[model samples]
Target chain A: MKFLKIIFLISITFSLYAGEYAVVVNKKNKIDKISKKQLKNIFLKKRHFIDNQKIVAINVSANMPLRMKFEKSILQMSREKLNSFWTKQHFHGISPPLTQSSTNSVKLFVKNVDGAMGYLPKNLIDDSIKVIYEF
Target chain B: MSFKLKTILLVLSVSLIPYAVIMILMGSTLKKEYTENTLQEMQTQLQLNVDRIEQYLKTLNRDMHFMSRMDVMNDIYSKDLDKRISYLLMEKKKDLEIEGDFYLFDKNYKIIASSNKNILSDSKKINKFIDVEIISGFDNTKIGNLILDFSLKNFTKFFSNTKSRNYYIIVDKQKTLFLEKKFSNALKVQMPLKNKTNIEIVLQEDKEVFQNILKEYEAWFYTTLFVGALLISLIALYFSNRLIKPIISLSKAANIITNKKDYSYQVDVNSNDEIGKLSHSFNTMITSMSNVLDELKAESENKIKLLQEQSKNEMLEELSSNLSKYLSPQLYASIFSGEQSATLSSKRKKLTVFFSDIVDFTDTTDTMESEDLSELLNDYLNDMTQVALKHGATVDKYIGDSIMLFFGDPESKGVKEDAISCVIMALEMQEHMNILHKRWINKGFTKPFKVRMGIHTGYCTVGNFGSENRMEYTIIGSTVNLASRIESSAIPGEIFISEETQILIRDSFETKEELKITPKGFKRDISLFSVKNENKKTNKIILNEKGLSIVYEPDLQDATTKKDLKKTLEEFITKLSV
Candidate 1:
């Protein structure tokens, strides 16, 4: 019981200090914002298009702290649960979102692809991409 | 060369040489064609393998291009965060069964996605066996390049290496891969990969392997040629023997015939070919020659028989000529003419018989040398015979120095003419004795011969009289005896004729009555006459006898020679009187 209390206390402390992240697309995208549910659907491959255009979702690598924070804050799932969900979705001919090793590559990916979107730290946002959602 | 050897050579030349040449030509042609066809097959196989390699490369290039164009390539912008492109590349590499890796490079030439995980994120160059541009699907722009690190082992699935055939890769005409063995005298084929220009597929087929097969075929072909040559030689021998056998026998027979001079030799005929015909013709020629020789022998024998007959006839002619001296010419002619038969037979005919005697020939021969006497006697008889023959009298016989003759027996003019011929012959014989007496005295024989002749014509038996083996052609009976008696009574140099002969000869000669005598068998005395030549005159008288020879020529003698002759005659008369 004491080991579980210490793990809960450390998680809450990390959540208080976590930096804000935004889901961004190329600057040429018309969309200004996205609902959290829509972002979830896009990342999970449940929704394939946005605003009548095919959408490509991007993610950070699995070992990234930002990826863990995003999964905790928005996916509301653990790493094991997300991995099992994507594994199940693979049978349905649906794939998880593309991943990048760093926030810089994630930003570069969203900046280059027109219908591509990816989450990044807010401080790393640049003029090459547009923020469609912030958290 | 002998006929058999010649024939064998002919057959071998005709049959074997051309056959051997054709066999060699065919064997060489077959080997050449087979080798060409084998090379062609090898080339076809190489081309098929090359085609498969090209097709595989095309498919690989297209697959690479298709993968590069996939929507999943959009993830290259995200650096394949989901590793989807790399997974696809690995799957293609496995599907191609290539011995190389597939890698996706970003714009900076950094390997972002690769089938080989160890090479992930490695920086690489654009040089590769095959490469394709990675285009972002949403932006429609080039993002990176997909490349393959190709290995020569990848062509192993298309072609494999064997003892006789080998496959390899040549890169840029310098770099050789896969099999590195150097091949000498091999068939080499190379083609560049369509997608990889620097890479070539090289196929080599070792010619030594095909050469080995060709050598085996050549050995077999030569063996067959040897066997064929042997068979041809055997056939040549058999045919030469068959063809030359008759000719050899013919030669042998010819030799035998030449040496032995025989024409009965023949050759055997066994076939209906030309040789058989030649043998038959040879036999026919031999038979014809034999027949001709036989005819020549027969003709020659006939010629010899004719020659012998001719020689016998010549001998007979010579013998008859010799015998003619012993016979009267008329009798010899009559016998030769087939008119007279030599047999004991007689005919009664009026024959004028003549008789002559050398008076005192015996007494003269006793006084003279036998040689001189015989010479004188032969001279006298020869002269007498010539005279008698001139008158056509047949001489009957000679008893010592006496000769008996007749006419009208073998051939006669009637009895009157015969008697006249006989008396004339007797007168001629007395006259010829005068010539003999002169010849004898000149030859140193002083004694001369005196001949007395008598003739009579009467019916007498005149014919061949004697034994069958020994016969005389003569006249016999009283006419012959009376003629002898008349001859004895004749003066030494006188001719006396009986009355019958006188009557017959009176017309041809002058006759005077000499005397009359009754012969031993006569009943009355017959008057004898002396015959004288009518045209001759008595100019001289010659009397020659034994111990008495008087020749008085009144006109030729001078008075002194006449007195000397008269003295010799008177002395001879005194010697005769004593």
Candidate 2:
């Protein structure tokens, strides 16, 4: 058991230096390098139109690590806070972003849809999607 | 009931029966419609809520799956990733709009991160695993469990349209999950949740909605029925009055006519209906009755007048019969035969008048009993009146025991014959006095009652000579006075005649004595003569012997009567000699 404890501690210490995530948009998008607050606004549906183009925000599943990192780093909100915020937005006829099951699907949605934005690990990022921000 | 009331009730009932039945049917139908519509509306609302809940659940599942696949899940093995996991959980809670905590646990069930920080210290076991999702690493290896405790509050807000109502999601008889508000009593509607096992949503409905709808419909039903009944009753009353008023008035008029028995009264019939015609017929009956009564009254009056005339005729006949004894036969006959009128007018005519009376009647009455005296006087007067009527003299009147008679007035032979008749009547009356005297002697009256009479013939006023009320058919003139004067001067048992009467009867009668009678009303003395009839019975021989006197009528020229008389005389003389 002591050995197992030493192993668990080493594994936890190694996970602390995990790699960063990236926020990507469609390759055809005109603007890049969006602010963290603007990304948060996009996900919350507060700023649907930017640069005269309708934006479509996408999200990963609730239990996904990349989505958790994106919520903490870019949106800077917890799961409970987003739930409450979207519920309030629903009263004003607004909706949260669309969701995907995997990082590859998120990348594919961003590649296919105009003004689409999503987050994924840096390794999963491809030429089809343009990385707007990294958090 | 009165006619108007009956009529109104009849009409009202006729309309009200069908209307009430239709209203009842309509009310029931409306209530059925309300119930059906309410059920359909509740069903639609329940379905919408069910759709919303399913959609929310789907979103939660999709989001949890997406989060599990993120590259940030690699940080799960790192000791410094607890804050990051906690923040991610909190974000998920906010995004899902839940009032519940979220938890990230390691493979060993040890809590790693949670949205509610206080949940880490509590050793209490979880009430349930509402949504337990797997959290995976970047290599698709299982990392931990992601749990979400969903609050029913937001779903309750979605279905909060019903207040004072309750909803429960009952998993068993005892375990119930309240969706909106907690309630003890409820109507249960079972709803199945999508992609769920052995779980159902129970929708509860309050009875208040149905009750309110029924109350509104009831109000409308009663109001419409009441207004319809009132309007129909008013119309019935109006029409009934129009139909019944004339009949009532006609009945009143009929009552008046019967009670008063006045046929002149007329019924006021304004309309030309059957009642008006009846009134006209009644008026005709009264008129006919009144006319018949008038005719009966006139006929009765005529009968009464005729009876009165017949009775008056009977009375006059009786009076005239009694008066005929006072008038002379000829005068009575002439007046009754319409030959003479009873006007008080006198005419100058030659008449032979006669007067007669009892001589010393006062003296005889003083000596005799009154009854015997009246008897003897009636006997003498009866015989003298017989002799006067036998000579055709009109006996005018009798003043006590005296008589005045005239001839040649109502009926006459001639002036000369009238004088002769008057003289003969006077002479016969005097001769009748002798017979009456003998009759009185046999009646035990010693004194003889003698009568004196006189006759005259001259121009005299005769006929009805008195006033209109007491006119008498009598002679009144110098001739009448002269006859009265002659009667006064004559001796008892004698008749005197004036010169005119004596000359008229000189060839028929013998004069016994002559005298001058100057009456008080006469201007000159009237020569009167005591008269006897030439056919008087003076041939009788009277012989007195002893105390007896005998009277004999001898027929000497007849041999048979002379022989018989001689034989009787011889027997009487021989008896006297012996």
Q: Give the number of the best model, judged by lDDT.
A: 1
Instruction: Evaluate residue B185 in candidate 2 and report its C-alpha lDDT on the 0 to 100 scale.
Output: 48
**Cα lDDT of model 2 by residue, B1-578, tens digit:** 87767887888788888888999899899888876776676667677877888898788878877776664543344321335667787787877678777776666767767778676654245433354556443224576766766565545655644674544565544456666565454445666666653455666666555576578779888999999888877877777777776677667766876898665666665667786777667667767776787788798898898889878878887888887877787888889998779898778998888888888878767887888777776776677778878878788878888988887877777777677667756766767777877887788887776778877788998768778798777777777877788888888777888887777766555775576756887778778787765643457553323234444555333888788878987998899899
Q: Give candidate 2 regions above 4 Å deviation.
A: A1-135, B1-344, B348-354, B358-366, B369-371, B374-395, B407-459, B463-474, B479-578
lDDT by candidate, in order shown: 0.81, 0.72
* Superposition error at B67 for model 1 (Å): 3.8
Model 1, B491: alpha-carbon shift in Å?
4.6
Q: What is the TM-score of chain A alone in each candidate?
A: 0.82, 0.81
Listed in order, the DockQ scores are: 0.20, 0.02
Which candidate wins on TM-score? Answer: 1
For candidate 2, the lDDT comes to 0.72
